[model samples]
Target: MNNSLKTIAFISGIVILAYGVYTLFKPETQISIGDVDLIETQDNTNSYITIAVGIVIVALSSIIGKK
Candidate 1:
């Protein structure tokens, strides 16, 4: 049970980290109309939240695995 939990934590961390990176790195969508440029960007809050969650999960997994 302990090992399984650790594995889950590690996997979840990696997935979340990837999502965070994608969210942070994705380019804004831009639309140009008659010399007007409109750009839509991702919310910075969600990326930070995922990054924090990912780090926490990875840390917990390592601590658990060491036991």
Candidate 2:
């Protein structure tokens, strides 16, 4: 049903949004040696895109079946 689809979309959007936010703050890679530590910084481009997509999905779900 349309309602079920909307519910699924809403949940998926929240999940995606959470994932995007998590990745945005999460470190990409890390390495540790005897006296040296290295960390790779994350590129926010993907996270931003994911967040945008999630927002769009959530918005669409809210408008589904509306006149």
Candidate 3:
């Protein structure tokens, strides 16, 4: 990994983490796709996933570029 990559990862991680927290607290949304309607909701499983991914990205930014 390089400094640029680490920077990108760090920024991306922050964005993902922020969005994850935001969505976790926000209400669900209803959407229709090709006549199939779906209601989106956040659960613990998803919360964990986003949090994990974000943490992994941030950790990678710290660990990957240097010793």
Candidate 4:
């Protein structure tokens, strides 16, 4: 049971990390009019937070697994 839980955490962490990276690089808003492109960029605070959370979770899971 514990191993299964750890596996789930690891998978979820990877997914969250991937999602954070995707959001960090992807544009939030884009508009193209007559060959003119307008992109609305936002701060990456959320992405950073998500990435941090994922890293922490992964680290915790691995650390616990070693015990």
Candidate 5:
């Protein structure tokens, strides 16, 4: 049971990490804040940072399990 739970958790972490990577590569839709147009460009630096954080999270979860 514990192993199954761990596997599920690991898979979930990987999915989340993949999503973050996709968001990093994918172009963000433009948004308008009042009269100013806010465009989100693909920021590799930020993306990598996010990915790193996600990895850390996954690593911690794998070590500690869930909470």
Candidate 6:
């Protein structure tokens, strides 16, 4: 049971990491309203920072699971 749980946790961690990476590279689009063009800015640095935090959480979970 413990081993299976660990495996599941590890897989989830990998998925989160992948999702974070994808978010970092995903393109942001914007629409124009009337005479104004609305631009949606995607800050890659901020996205990467969020991903780093997620990775840290996953790492912590993995560590706790080992116990």
Q: All candidates: CA RMSD in angstroms?
A: 1.4, 1.6, 6.2, 2.0, 6.3, 3.7
**Candidate 3, residue 45: how far the Cα is off, in Å:** 2.0
Off by over 4 Å in 6: 30-38, 43-50, 61-67
For 1-67, candidate 1 gives per-residue lDDT tens digits of 9899999989999999889989998888899999999988667899999999999999989999674
Error of 1 at 9 (Å): 0.9
- TM per candidate: 0.86, 0.82, 0.68, 0.80, 0.52, 0.59
The candidates, ranked best first by TM-score, are 1, 2, 4, 3, 6, 5
Higher-ranked by lDDT: 2 or 4:
2
On the 0 to 100 scale, the lDDT of residue 17 in model 5 is 83
Q: Write the per-residue lDDT of candidate 6 for residues 37-56, one digit (tens) a residue.
A: 98898878866776786687
Tell me the lDDT of model 3 at 48: 68
Q: Output the number of the TM-score-best candidate.
A: 1
Clashing pairs in 5: none
- lDDT of model 3 at position 9: 93
Q: Give a tens-digit lDDT track for model 2, residues 1-67.
A: 9999999999999999999999898866989998899987778999999999999999999999688
Question: What ranges in model 1 sit over 4 Å off?
Answer: none
Per-residue lDDT, model 4, residue 46, is 94
Looking at model 3, residue 25 earns an lDDT score of 78
Worst 10 residues of 3 by lDDT: 40-49
Residue pairs in steric clash, candidate 3? none
Segments in model 3 whose C-alpha atoms lie over 4 Å from true places: 28-42
Model 4 poorest 10 in a row by lDDT? 58-67
- Per lDDT, the best of the predicted structures is 2
Q: In order, what lDDT does every prediction score?
A: 0.90, 0.92, 0.83, 0.89, 0.76, 0.76
Write candidate 4's Cα lDDT for 4-39 as tens digits: 889999999999999999889986798999999998
Please give the distance, in angstroms, between residue 2's alpha carbon in candidate 2 and its true position after superposition: 0.9
lDDT of 5 at 42: 57
